[model samples]
Target: MLRIPAVIAVLGLSALTLAACASSPSSAASTSCERTDSDASVLDFAQASGDFGKPAVTLKAPVYVDSTTYTDTEVGTGRQITSDAQDVVFSIAIANGATGQSLVQAAPPVQPLSSWNSSYQGLVTAMMCATEGTRVVAAIPASELSAAGAQDLGVTDDQSIAVTIDITKVYLAAADGTPQYNDRRGMPSVVLAPGGRPGVIVPDAAAPTELAVEVLKKGDGETIGQGDTARVQYTGVNWSTRKVTDSTWENGASVAVAPGSKLAFAPQLVGATVGSQLLVVVPAGASGAGGDAATVYVVDVLGIDDPAATN
Candidate 1:
């Protein structure tokens, strides 16, 4: 069975280095700016019209300070970010603190919050605990930017980084991989909630005599092989009661799994394709947990993280 902890480590490591901001700074620094408490008035932000994912951002020059600070110009009424691994989608505009000149504007303007490296203290601090639909302005300390990071933004080591982030949506990280589709019958039917959470309706007949696996949706990405890690969203229903006992969707996060791990669903996921949705039925006595009652699971493969390549 695949363990959730192992999967989290793998997926977290793979996504840790993704950067949402553009690679190159927009302008040269004219002077050094001092860091101060977060003051939204000091930085004027003009968001683009149309889709929230592709908002155009305009902000006034901000004064950089020693400490990283942020303010929520608009608070979101949606879900709150509770974990580092929760995928945060937002549009960001980065600028030089000293000159208030634009630095990097993410072209599509939407990316996962975890895409940013943890070394970026300011970015992380600004985003933590923020809810979806919130608009934030953060001032990053110059010390927070590494020499390489400063170079990428075409700023001197002494300059701070200022940014405006428009929170769009937050989603759990999905698992990945790909394979041909397979068709099967007599499996439990599935209905999805508005948020993509699945509702599994088990048949009224007796439980299957053996483990039954069905691929409801096949992905077109990488393949999950032995030792490869996968991130997934899933819900488990006890056959006898037809009640959901466990769910990543309810918890608002995805789980990682590797083949041969302790996770009951690991073996089934080993050969599944990324982006595939699976319905698995484990017979009561066949289940490893002291021959517990049968359980039904609806699994969505979101992404794959190869341990060999990541290590």
Candidate 2:
């Protein structure tokens, strides 16, 4: 598995988050299933422990796959995916259906559902209408694998691809990026569009003279600790101008933050619970940029990046 930074540096904000690959098990035995077709028997499927405490898939060996097929190894009881879902996050194990050799096994990563590419039809089908915690095994004909995908697997156009996907989370596309509710008065308001992008609405009154922090949404996951890497989506606005300085929402990705970054609001993020949203106000001269005007930030803490689990 390869660990890629969840976030990248961008204008106005110090950094942005991106997706990364995680590791998986090498092999496992397949479960008993009645083969519907001769070609289907060529591939055997099993579920096993993956890297970083995540679920992994094991294939016995590859066989000639003449057509695309899928099986629901486990059905989830969490949120049911709707057609309106904008993005899906899941882990996957991909291998050559003909040789049964592992191509790539990745931990959960966010994927857009609207991509209509023919090569991605297998993934799209596996995610559409699926619920959180669902485990799916899909076998795709070699013709269906995209050129890039085939190349990545080091297979020719004649080889089929088998993939197992574990659905972990799904997010509805934000309609206008506006928050549905607000409780903090005398503070700049925040609105979120689809994809968790935030828009700051500064109040007519003068910016607060001291640091102000508010929790827009409280998460129930793990608590963030100092020096721990955090995966988050956020937006920054200049108080006086009410203009967006930087935002991960615009990039359609979340970012991972390391400890001691120059971000003025990073300290406030520590000790915050996962899945919580924070709104912080940095008074003039407090933003560390020595500016005369203040800055407001809207942050959504997605999760704590596990340093040991990522790679």
Candidate 3:
């Protein structure tokens, strides 16, 4: 739902192809599970040093490129980026390749590559397959830059830009755990796509009279405690029409929710473990649900994020 240029229009990156993209991305790309290997030599004109998150970049001004390219300078053993919608926490540095001038630097929020891809597809490719603690360098050609963004940055399409990124954390792409048994009668059913995206099928039955929950998948990770922020991918539908009402899949981003969150199922999820898939039923008269209609939610608890640690 969040696009690139739309964000830039807010922050003023007239030419930083991704200036607008920096706003937010509800986005992902191809289905290939293979790692995106790169040729590190392509970025010889640009170099980076100093600490991981705080990087100092030196570039040969007036750089030029005909295409976008990237390479990993350091790799971590943590989980890899499985899909475009996978959440990641990282810091980035942006610079003008042609003038060797630095632009903005930031440690952004817990978002998916899908969000960045919506603005600059090149950025997704640069971070693809990268694991936590991995450091990457990407060279983006002006032609690949957003026309409006580059124009605002005062960078000509013929000029290039340099970027250095440090990925600190990565979240699960889906609920990777053992399947759980379900014996609840008259409950909605959930089906998962190959990438672990879920689809719901609500039975033509009466909506529950109270808050109801069932675990469709169980994980071996830590149990969610009070105040823990659960990052999840979920889809919600109205029981009456069975038409979709809200979905992270459509947005290509996962959200961080608290226990008993009204935005989610409004039920306490204290004991739920990470990597668990929850089937939640919110009755029509439930508190704070606005009583539009009964709603069914299939939520994939991807992971738990420390609200303080995350941006």
Candidate 4:
């Protein structure tokens, strides 16, 4: 946890962090984020400057807020976080609004927007419209904090906390692309949930003798390069029993894997664009099942992860 409220009084400022290791998917996002002149003027009370993740701040005066308020100081050119199911890599620096004393500030942690909202409700609206590389400031009134949180931070009922949130990375909530047409004649059919999770329905007919590929949705993003690690959501079902054998959706997180032929469908996915959804059929041994049954996989190419990028 970063020095954010989740552990502020106990662990101190350096303890707040948004580690982007493993996390979950999205909920509907509000596009109606408001930025008022008054709020913007209030946010300006705290001047922040430094490297992106960890900000340096020197408050001009002790500030107070009647309600939650926020505004962006810098707008990033990267992907926008439009859904709660989406997870993000972010950092923070918070201080007691009435005392102008630092309380929390840390960098580089990852979690879903829903999780962040649960920890600091006031930050949610600001985050909804945030993009990778964004820097935003928010003021949370004491009323916004849980009674326990206010007590832990030693803030009076009328006091508040001001924080700077740096959004470094943004992960997609689901596959976003144009629908495709494929001859799924006797192949397993695929269906999608509201959040873009996929379900595979194995046909009651014989599995294909050779490898099979079907394009469920054609993405408009970058083409996945061979040997590149890709972020994805997938489900594997046994054609024989029509039972699911594996799924990333169950774990509530997307995983990054390098594309190659060792797993049968991995290589076939290399040329697929980010955001594309595919259905592939792998027979028994080829699927690494070592059984008589074949496996059908439905995968969503969420995005491509550059290994060199920071967490």
Residues 251-299 of candidate 4 have per-residue lDDT tens digits of 6555666775355578777899977888888877775543688888888
Which residue runs of candidate 3 sit more than 4 Å off their true CA positions?
A: 1-32, 60-62, 264-266, 308-311
Residue 168 in model 1: shift from native, Å? Answer: 19
Give lDDT tens digits, candidate 1, residues 91-185: 66666777766665542212345445444556766776777787777777767765555565666766777777777655333322243355555
Q: Which candidate is the best by lDDT?
A: 3
Q: After superposition, how far is residue 21 of candidate 3 from its true place, in Å?
A: 12
- In Å, residue 160's CA in model 3 sits off its true spot by 1.2
lDDT of each: 0.60, 0.59, 0.71, 0.70
Sorting all predicted structures by lDDT, with the top scorer first, yields 3, 4, 1, 2
lDDT of 2 at 181: 60
For model 1, state the Cα shift of residue 22 in Å. 30
Q: Which 10 residues in a row give candidate 2 its minimum summed lDDT?
A: 20-29
Instruction: Give the range of the ten consecutive residues with the poorest summed lDDT in model 1.
Output: 24-33
Better of 2 and 4 by lDDT: 4
Which digits, one per residue and each the tens of the lDDT, describe model 3 over residues 187-210? 998887767777889998898888
Candidate 2 residue 27 Cα shift, in angstroms, is 34
Worst lDDT 10-window in candidate 4: 13-22
Clashes of each: 26, 16, 14, 15
